[model samples]
Target: MRYHIGDLNPEELLDLYRAMLKPRMIEEKMLVLLRQGKISKWFSGIGQEAISVGVTQALREEEYILPMHRNLGVFTTRNVPLNRLFSQWQGKKSGFTQGRDRSFHFGTQEHRIVGMISHLGPQLGVADGIALADLLRRKRRVTAVFTGEGATSEGDFHEALNVASVWNLPVLFCIENNGYGLSTPTKEQYNCKDLVDRAKGYGMESRIIDGNNILEVYTKVNELCNAMRKRPRPILLEFKTFRMRGHEEASGTKYVPEKLMKKWAKKDPIANYEEFLLEKGILTEAIIDGYKNEISTEINSNLKLAFDEPAIDSNETKELNEVYQKFDYEYFEKSEDVENIRLVDAVSQGLEQSMERYNELIIMGQDIADYGGVFKITEGFTAKFGRSRVRNTPICESAIVSAAMGLSINGMKAVVEMQFADFVSSGFNPIVNYLAKVHYRWGQNADVVIRMPCGAGVGAGPFHSQTNEAWFTKTPGLKVVYPAFPDDAKGLLTTAINEPNPVLVFEHKGLYRSVYGDVPKNYYTIPFGEANLLRSGESLSIVTYGAAVHWALEILDKHPEIDADVLDLRTLQPLDVESVFRTVKKTGKLIIVQEDTLFGGIASDISAMVMENCFEFLDAPVQRVASLETPVPFAKNLEAKYLPKQRFEAALLELYAY
Candidate 1:
């Protein structure tokens, strides 16, 4: 089924020709900007413009788009100001990322275009999640995800495609087969002749299109998008194209053979489409010239607007003051009348209550629905609300996190769980780069809660056992909560679920089944960044959280004469410096404790914060008590020795003596 330019109206043909010319001109200008020392670098989508421009044009304004770095054509066609692109290259305030993000890293919610991630293949999962959100809301919108052929090798690509196919999501996986991924040719990377064949492995319908033919690309994409909007099924479209320039501005074509480069360049998409338009009489030479002139004028006008646009002042305070900007005091107030309940039951009750309260809340994760999650936190969720609200995902951590981010962006509250916190590295990119930073980058908020089982007191060793709260403690836009008791866990988890940002709720392995104080049977939330002072004393401040919080309390009890002020950091990212300072002022000594390794752990951060913020009040050098720097040993004897039990107790005793 060969679609030709002759089948389209003169206006449509001219528009395609104009679209081809504009992106090329923009790419050429970007190179000039790079050479002139105005911009640091640039990535050219020169030969791949036809497919990007055409596919984006076929989709409606409300539909979502997630493009990789070499997608200037899609952004330009979607009405992203070219000047902002250039300014981003120039590291100016008027740039899309406000001088904070690198070139081609711009995204706008107003344009229905999600931010571009430089990392390959991560966006596939993000797009899948977006499609799922559209499916849940019954909205007639498709999510288009674009990436190079090389991205196909990433596990996230397979994960996203499989999930999207299984769920029948309205997502278009557009693979721009530019022949080469940087210096590596597709033949060298994969054995298949057609990239579309990989889609069959995931049980998805796919097509191979001549990406150089703008009319063919646009028509086929339009048909697929329309079909998806009707039934919400995933489709894979492999667009065959070429890269006219090197991988990036800094890359030299020394590795790429000149003969192959010339061969691909001879089949230039822009030139071929221009000839097709002229040969078919769909657009006259004069009409083509006029269209080019008109598009050029528009591009120039947008460039001027981008230049004249006010640069975002980096010196100004960030707008996210709820919890990320400063410590939230209201949620931290101590509850004198705390109820008694099992920690795991408290979590399950909180989730069940919240879902009942908010109709928009959706829960998803591996073994979450019928399996009730690994710890039975989501037990009976599917029975109560049905599968649509409580979904069980494939064992793809990247897809789970990305989908949560996408759903949150489109105005749905998502509570995504990880089977274990140790496996979070699989979805770390979306959690850190996309979900955590999207609100600050795109000037919008995403209300999503990611719950994971963390900490190592149980016998789960190595891969299954890890305290990873410190891994994300310094991430600027995310809220990291680690609750020690049943009441604190329930309250903080509820608060994180309701907060208008991506939040990581780390449930300690030791605390999940531990017997703890009762939780109130009512709707309540504990705010982030406020510490709970479990015990008050004048000798030293024992700062801790999660499982270690319980350990610290126990140690303080064993030695009542120690007189230590026990501070539980409910949230890690938004550290309560004021409270720590006040406690240190009263005690004049500090002891930081955690279940993780002492080196480069949460204890280090607490120690540094005390030294920097409360140095004047310190009477002795701040001490840190943490687990030994080794994988949690499998043997019970070694495990006990590897743990931070003695270190925490010794640190408290030493601080009291000081």
Candidate 2:
């Protein structure tokens, strides 16, 4: 509990010195390796070492810390092996990311570290989610997240702070004010006098500390941790510091004024701490040289081992086995206990069953609490799961998704709901770049699901009625499922919750109340990448998903003369290509339909696959019936023409006649 340098013993003071000194020594040597082309890139934390070291030392082992690229001292101080760190720098198989990414861009659960996304601001929200997990588990741990002064300008900064303050979660937001974003100064970044001053907008507690004084940082952060542990709350700490080196080794710091650099050189964190310890008789020249010699030998010997480690590459099956967490894709079972229900009720029952099964499962979205969301899918969730499990988030899509990632990092499953599928554009950065990429980058599975209410038949116009399932199907490391019937909706959504990786459940808004089917009362799952044979005929193959499936069914029942084999693709991402080809080969013709526009729809990809692989089996040319390349219109006649339903009959007849 004694945090002040004056109250510390000689050994404890030396520990602090060693923690700060090792990163400086390693990075100083990394400069030599960069010149020799041994490592491709390095982000220097030369003078800003105290922020990382002091923060790491002040927190408990279980408390997670999300770090930016420049926080190398956090890794070193935590005692992650020198060889593994160096292996990462060398793109070797033994690295933290298995050579998938370089630098401190990956996190290891072994160290309770969640590496920041390249965007630099989403980690703050992740910290909030980790803190939320601790609170739910009744643990006395506070989450720490770091960012540069430049990142405060991002909208995520506002969302993370506001959400933490609103919920009163235990989080310490450390802003390393290193004077530059890449080349831009703090003056050009924001109008605030200091970065901590921005915390007032969220009505949160804040402090300004001299980051160069390691003791001051350690002492103040330690006291704050003790306080937050007792009474959970969020605080913003602005660590006034400077980047003594360039952003990376390749970029020179010529843009920074020489006079300013000279002024900060005198305030070097390691030197400042060393001088105090020396005056107190806690350090000697021998101790300094002794640390340097010890660290140098460790770096050199480990560099050799790292050099010998094999450099991993894509498709190296033996080395890349853990890229993404494997799931039991065959979790589905048929049950005789059935009831007629709408698609929305089936979805609600599926969520309820998943919640009853897994206590760690959390559902979060705007107006999803007492209001029960706009679509009423989560009408009674808050009452059953409590506010902690069924949380109502601010209208912050990016932070909401990032917070789910944080929850996943803490070994919890999360389901984030976007009221309208069109709103996914706001959270695209984290969904595509972070959630979709983290597993492949670091092998950290994001066990999160995003419920997307999509489609265009409701006449909600372009913004609310956009079928954007195609956007996510192109992205890897994510499962995309769209169901037309209630049976498949409950089955696929339950499967999504059970999945270890991120899954997007595109629940068609039109089918929620309109479509009805016999769904099992008991819990069950439907395997992904499996197609349902809805109708069997030899005339032609009608392939579709979502609302278009119903339109195809309507056309077939009205005219029994047109015999067609209908294949309902439950999942678009894993896309049952085998079934598509089978149906194509059986009928010797095909027609792919979707609610989305025709230009760049998922139909084009399926058409290409059919032409490439199943061309010889086809008796006639393949055709695609889709909406025109335009936004959904509000007018009834225009919307009717914009959707694929009106053209389904003609396309099917043409394909059947061929």
Candidate 3:
């Protein structure tokens, strides 16, 4: 389409001008606040306000937005109350995150804007998922995600764009080419001349506009957005602009050339827009001054209110007030008829049952469709639920996680599978930063279950065989579940799906087909923060979970002389603390065993808890048996030496003697 200067009506043009002016002024005030030591940091969008305002103005009221930190103009344009914005920046209790997060790190489900984190690019896939949900619902809406030129280097950028293009999702990926990432120039950042050119590789429609010119941005974005609503497809829109300031307040522009700064100053978005409006007889100097005064008074009043608001108490900030939504699984009834089932089959059955009960549930993973998965845990799922519900995703772990988060955000219970638990390292940012904090930060439901095939007994080597439960357990706002038995596997998996929170299920790879037990045919849910007493003896307390649960049982059954109380902790995050401490009191001597490495594992946490609670009850010092600190070796004998059994038996004898 040809660029038209007069596309937007005069009233719309005036609104756009005001929109650009709002953030520019707000950022200026934020800089002053930063200097005053009120606000700690400021990511200014002084010269780049046009793009943020124009893009937001082009969108419909209901369209979803995922904005980066610099896009304060986008927030103002979205009709976000200025008081709340000030409250968030001031770190007051009235902030969107209740002062948990400062600055632009706040969003609400009501506004349909998923807030950006320090890790910016993962939100692209999340926006894609929202677009996917809109498409599924046949809703004529677009999802706009904003990021900087440097973010194109991230794996999530490529993954999100590829998935959106392949699915023909109604996603508008807006890249603000502000010439620098922190202090590094765009020339040094990437090999390409224009980042928007990469859109051709994904078969997406591309457009580049003068970001400083609000009319050009508004016209082109408005046109494309209208077209996308009719036929959903991803659009890569590049806004060529300038930051006009350092990355943040403390980050001065000493590294930025003076010449470039002076040149961008002449092209200030707000000043240029005001000049154009004045020349066109659209806005007189008096009207412009009145608008500026009105905005200034509004900002000052809101700032005073926000500044007067009390800060959250230090005691409140100690732990994230992550609200866990209680799930009632009355529909899940235990079956009297027990059938011998493999752990893997039990997981598959549990998923099928959940999907049968909740039709909105969807399963996604690599090779999970026709191929079932690398472990075949999702075998026959596609045939049962069809390819729509049981989706086969790409090898990109981050995309899978972010997209699943988006699915959950859009009211679908997403059950995603990580091909191997080790591969989760690639998608760790979204899992830890995004998915985990979604509900805690925004008060929205992040109902996604990530099934991780964990553990290292079968010698799958470093990349494939990592017991990463501790990684997720350490992260707040996530529920971690690991089950040792077939019954618990089915029950817990069901619970994870039903629960309205992000749950990471660590399914041991070695026990998938190797272990079998009587599992009920009926649906059931194993409550979190609950432990099962596998063996009732009191020589010592052997607290363990997953594959190690059976190992501890084996050791006790073999050596009846070393009789012990075995407790299986099903959930790791909301740990079964009461049961563990009770058993520790009974046994006096406690031995914590885990399949993960000796250092930085769950065993240390259990030992510390025991020391804090049952220190006086101990007959001897607490001992722990865990895998060696080294990475899992490829050789079978070396890998076997690296794990428990040998360590456990030796620890048992030493503690028995002690």
Candidate 4:
């Protein structure tokens, strides 16, 4: 079918024209507010509103749109109240994010619009996941995700496309190729002549459009939307346009040469489309002015209302609001008796129970389906649950994380496994920037658990043996749990799954097989911010978790005179400060041991907390023992030397002497 401006009826043509004009006027008002010092910043979509505004008009309300910072026109097209948009820019409590976020970093669950983080590339992978869910449920709805040409440089762009192609997900990867990435032009940004060429390798459909023509954009996207509903597949749509202004209002257009600016000036999307409507006799000048005046009045009234709304108080925003999902403890309680089980067995069992209890729970990882995972932790799971629930994903770690985020956002619970915790660096953007901050920024706890099999001691090299829980602990709105015993591991995993928050479960591979104890067959939870006291002693307090707890116990057994109180910190993010203070007051000396590197490790934070809280009770300075700063070595001899036994023993002796 031929797709063009002629496809639309007279009313539809006028609707498109009004849609473009609304955002154009709103941004003009925003620039005025920016200059008047009312709003902090402005990202104007001055010349590039056509694709977003037009394509949004083509989409159904049930469909999802993942928009980046530049897509103000999409909001206008979706009929997002002008007051809310202005309130967001003004950082008012009445905004979508309740003043926690600004400039495209907001989403409403009712609208089915997932906001894009500053690092916008990863949301495409999330879009792929949302599309995957729709495909699995046979929803026949397409998810359109927007990104600039610069974001295409991110790894998530490639990963999202590859997975969407392989799974035949109904996702529209909308690329606004606006000639430059910040100050650098497209020539320097990528080697490809056209960005759509990259989609050829992924075996997906591609289309290039003159973004200046609003009707052409609407017709083409509308056609693709219908096509994807029948047979799901990703389509890369490249919109060639210009930013017309600076990257942000403050950045200025000094980078663009006058000659190039003049060239793009003639092809402004709004002006060009307005002329098209005039010549076609679809809209008279009087009718157009009437629409503009009506919208302008609406905009001004909303801005006034937004200004009158009370600002959020500083005390109200001081603490994180609703970081975790509220659930009764009885919901997670199991009726079965306790049984002796290995840590690994407890993990698989807990997972099976969680899945059976909650039908929406799903597990995804590399080699998790038939292969039963790298360490056999998921053995017999695929046979019991089937491949639909126990999914085997590709090696793209970021995609897995982002995909899980999307699923969680759509009212499903997900447990994602990183084959090895050390590989999490590959997927850090979505985990840290998107998943971790979603609750704090957008008021929804992403209900997902990432099972991280971490730490050294096995023959696995540096790539597989690193303990990086400290990195995630530092991130707000993220819960980090590290369990030492089989019972704790099973209980914590069960609890983490129940909580409506993005939790990182650090399962030490060394402890998975090496440890065995009584694990409850019935579901029970060890709450966050609670510490377990394994052995009591009066002389010293030894705080540790995971694999280090066993090592600390071994050292204490070797020297009975040390008489240490061993405390296991099950959850790191919500530290058990009360227990730590009590133990510090009783023992009068603190020794923190960790398997992670010495500098900036968990021990450092605990040591500081101890000094600040119970310093007067201490008989000596707080001591911390940890692994060497160097990478974990492959050689057994070098690895043993780098490990934390000798250092811990020395610290123990010094504390004993003190």
Candidate 5:
């Protein structure tokens, strides 16, 4: 059956032709630059221009969009600066990211275009998140995410689709089915021939369109977008187009069989649409020539602008570094007179006060709303704050964390509880990729707090006994806090909630019931990077935090003659390097202690910092007392052996001999 150009006016047809010509011209010039070694790599949407331009034009200006690397057509059609696009390809300061991010990782808040992430299929979840936000805000805006058929194989794709369909979110999932995922064809990847069939399983509206026919692509997308805006729901559109160019600049048609290449070449989407426009008398040969010349001139002008741009300076790089360092040490000054309160109560009071002051603050997790969390940290919050502010989430850890990230992105202050710190692995991806990197990627902060009960003193055994703070300490763009006493817990938690980045607050299970100290009822926030000196002596310095801080204090009390200086690192990521250097410089000896295994523990980082900052002042090598490198055993005696003890008396006896 022949697909007509549709009953559109001459002006509309000319617009479609113009959209097709711009991307094609850009792709053609990019290929020349790539071949001449001017650009490192190029991934062009040569034959698939019709599909991108048609679908994007059908979207509303306020609707959200997420495009993949081969989406130059969509960006060009949306009027993104061609100069910035070329600058990004050339890795120049004039690029969209100032040469920090890869090409095609472009974004513009003004245009409602969400940034493109390098990780495939993950954007699908991001699209759903944006749609969810729009729904909550009553914005009536749809989210359109474009990806390839290969992205469907990722776990995030299924997860996002299932959630979008279940919630009836306004999202348009466009799959550019160009017959092959790199070298692997669709038949090799799955048994089903139609990608739209997969969408039906999720109870979403699904359709397949002839991508080569610009009119058909635009007509279907327009209907879908209109229906979505009225009563929003998820829909999947699979555009069956052909890839005329190779995957990237380096790839060639050597692997592609001659017969198959010729077959796909016949159905080239751009060429077909141009011929259709010419046949319909909507475009003349002179107009086409003029369009090509205009596009060529624009490309050349952008190229010259990119080359003339100034180089990045070292100060600029340093300033970029400061942007990710969100933790401010100045706000964490210690009180001369410490308060006396229980650790659990201090945590609860901090959260309660924050919620009272900040109306946007919302808390959620297992048993948090009604049960006040497993440790009673959030007890009575639901009764006081109501259900909207204090929520109880299902047992899906991934979904809970991801939803918190989404909510935070939409201007809500979200505090998520992980029943136990060990259970954080379930939501690791969202924490690392979405929550932590969102601000760095888009220059938009997501203020979210993750509270978890951690450490290994309660005999909770293997699954519940692990300390995973080190895992996040190694990651950039995250704040890790571990407070020892009640006052510090209240103060640090207040700071964590107020900070504009993702913060992980690890509350020791033992300290929740054991430790007590004075905490003020007024609004007070503790700084994250400053260390607290529990006891000030000069012979040796014992540095620790969380449950170990209590043990160190006890040891210091028992052995008065040792003259040990006890330092508690309240925040692990932005460590108190100043306090550590001062103590090491005066005492000339250091000992680091932690409950986690010695291998890749937080103590290692402390030891490295000491060596780098105060190596000359050291009288002896720094020592570490940590749990053995084995899983916590169920047997009480074995567990005792597996955990790290203060051993202050023994250390004092040895130090006296020296």
Candidate 6:
């Protein structure tokens, strides 16, 4: 089948020509600026303009597109303000990222442009998320995601494809096969005959197109996307093209063969399209020069405005406060109307109530839908809310996290459950880098709640029993909560779900069913930055959370004489420094406990903060009791040795004695 300029009216042809030409002109101006040292960097998409601009033009206004650094054509074609793009390159405050980052390292929700991260593959999964939201809303919008030939080697690439295929998502995977992953050639990147053939391995339909041919790229992409909207399935379209310049301005194209560069230069998309338009009597030499002159005029005008823009103000940013959205909230404590339930049941009840309250709530995890999750936390979720609400994703942590980000972008609350906290390592990049920082980089608050079933006690071995909450706690733009009791669990979980930030809820696996407490029978939320003083005394301040909270209490139960203020830190990131300091000042002594290894645990941070703030009131030096620096062992005795229980007991007794 063939389609050409004949298939389009004169107006559509002119728009397409303008669309393809604008990015080239803008980038040419940027290159001159780059040489003048006015801009620090530029990733030239000189030869690959058609793939980005043509595909973007084919999509509807509401459809979301995830473009990469080199796909500036996508932004230009979407009519993103030229002043802003130039300002972004100049690191000006008016840029999309507010100078927090430069280049296309930002996304503009208004433009439906979710830009890619430097890692280059997580956006693929995020695309799956946007497509999922469109599917759920029953919207006829196809999400188009751009990727290079190199990113096809990433696990996130396969994960995104398989997930979109499995869910039959309306995602158009536009793979610009520009022949290199930075400097590595396509022959060295993958073993497949073509990137499109690999798409078939995931049971997805695919086609290869002449990316330089603007006519083909527009006609084919429009046709495929229209078909995708009706059928609502993922399609992979590999656009064969070349990188006519260096990977970036800094990297010279010395590595690229001169012969190949010359070959592609003759196939330059703009020049060829202009000639084609002229032959079809749709463009004259005079009109072509007029387009170039008009483009250059717009570029110079925007540059003048953007160059005058001020840089990002450091004082006004208030870096930490900008990480999260600020709103007044109440901490949910145990109400007189309560029922005793295990910790896991408290989580279940909280999640159920939240789902009931927010019809837009969606829960996803591996084996969470039908199998009820590895720990049976979501046992009957699928039966109640059906598959759309309670989704079972593939074991693609990165993809799921990015997908959750995508869902949140569309104004839906998403909860992702990791079977075990240790599994987060696989998804850490998206969780820490993308999901955690999205709000800070741009103003898009990721309404995501990741439930991490963590801690060591069930002898699940290192793979499943890691207390890794500290990994995310220290990361800015992420809220980390570790609830000790059922009341706190249910309440805090409620808040985490309802909040408009990326939050990590660490549910200690050991406390899942072992501990039970009274929780409100109805829906409620607990505000962050509030600590629970489980037990009070003047002798010492026992600072701890999660399973370690139980360990502290048990030690005190054994020694009734050990008078201490046991503080359960419900939320770690928005830490309750006031309660910690107050407790420390009253007792003039402090002992922090955590199940994680001693060196880099959140307990260490608490101990340091106490010393920094309450040092003058301290009766003695601060004490920290944590697990040995080793993985959680499978053996009963080995696991016991690896826990901080014994150390916590000794620390508690000694601190009280001090």
TM-score of each: 0.93, 0.98, 0.95, 0.96, 0.90, 0.98
Ten consecutive residues with minimal summed lDDT in candidate 2? Answer: 1-10
Tens digit of lDDT per residue, candidate 2, span 1-658? 1136657677877898999999999998999988888788989889988889989999998789999888998998778899999998888888887777878888989989888877888888889888998888989999999998988889998899999999899999999999998889888998878888878889899999988888888878999999999999999999999998888877889999999999999999888788877887888999899999999999999999998876676666843455458876756586899999999999999999999999999999999998899999999888888988999999999999999999999999999999999999989888888888888888889999999999887889989999898888888778899999999999999999999989999999999999989999999999889999899998899999999999999989998998889999999978999999999989898999988998778899999999999989989888998998898998888999898887888888877777
Q: Candidate 3, 250: how far from true, in Å?
A: 1.9
Candidate number achieving the greatest lDDT relative to the actual structure = 2
| Candidate 1 local distance difference test against the native | 0.81
lDDT, model 2, position 583: 92
Q: Report the Cα lDDT for residue 582, model 3.
A: 96
Candidate 5: give the clashing pairs: 332-527, 339-517, 339-518, 340-517, 340-518, 341-517, 341-518, 372-378, 372-379
Better of 1 and 2 by TM-score: 2
> In candidate 5, what are the lDDT values of residues 1-658, reduced to their tens digit?
1456567788888898899888888888878877788888877787788788888899887777888877777788889888887777776766666566667875666676765566665667667667776776677877888889887887667777877887788989999988677878788877887988998788999999988788889888888888898898999989988777677757765767789889878887767777776787777899988988888899889889987876644465754564463545435444466557789988998899899988878787887887777899888998899876787765656656665665565567789899999899877887787666665555656678999789887888998988889989887788899998888889999999988888999988888878877777676888778899988987888899888887877777766778888899989978988998899999999988888888899889889988998999998888887888998876788888788784534554565345
Global CA lDDT computed for model 3: 0.86
Per-residue error (Å), model 1, residue 581: 1.7
Query: Which portions of model 4 miss their true places by more than 4 Å?
Result: 1-3, 316-318, 322-336
**Which parts of model 2 have CA positions greater than 4 angstroms off?**
1-6, 313-323, 330-332
Candidate 2 clashes between residue pairs 3 or more apart in a chain or in different chains: none
Residue pairs clashing in model 3 are: none
Better of 1 and 5 by TM-score: 1
Q: Model 1 clash tally? A: 6
Tell how far residue 57 is off in model 1, in angstroms: 2.1
- Tens digits of per-residue lDDT for model 6, 1-658: 1237656899998888888888988888888888889999899899888889889988998899999988988998888999998888888988888888878899998999998889988999999999999899999999999999999889999999999999999999999999877788999998888889988689999999999998899988999988998899999989999998888878878888999889988988888888877877988888778888999899999999999887678764687678887655755555578898999999999999899989989999999998999889889988899999999998899999989999988778899999888999999999888988888888788999999999888989989999888898889889999998898899899999878988999999889889998888988888888899999997888889989888888888998887889999889988999999999899898888888899988878888888777789999989988999988899999999899898777777676766
List model 4 lDDT by residue over 1-658, tens digit each: 1226665688888888888888888889888988999888888789888888977987899899998878888888888888887888778887887777887898877778888988888899889778877776779999999999998998899999998898788999999999888888999989998999999999999999888888789888999999999888999999999989998888898989999999999998888778777887887999988988999999999999899989865564455555455556444564467787788888888788888888778898999999999989888888888887888888899988999888887778889999999999999989999888888777866888999999888878899999999999888878899998888888888888988889999999988888898877876777888899999999999999988899888988899888879999999978998999999999899999999998989899988988887879999999989999999998888888888987898889899898
Poorest 10 consecutive residues by lDDT, candidate 6: 326-335
Q: Give the TM-score of candidate 4.
A: 0.96
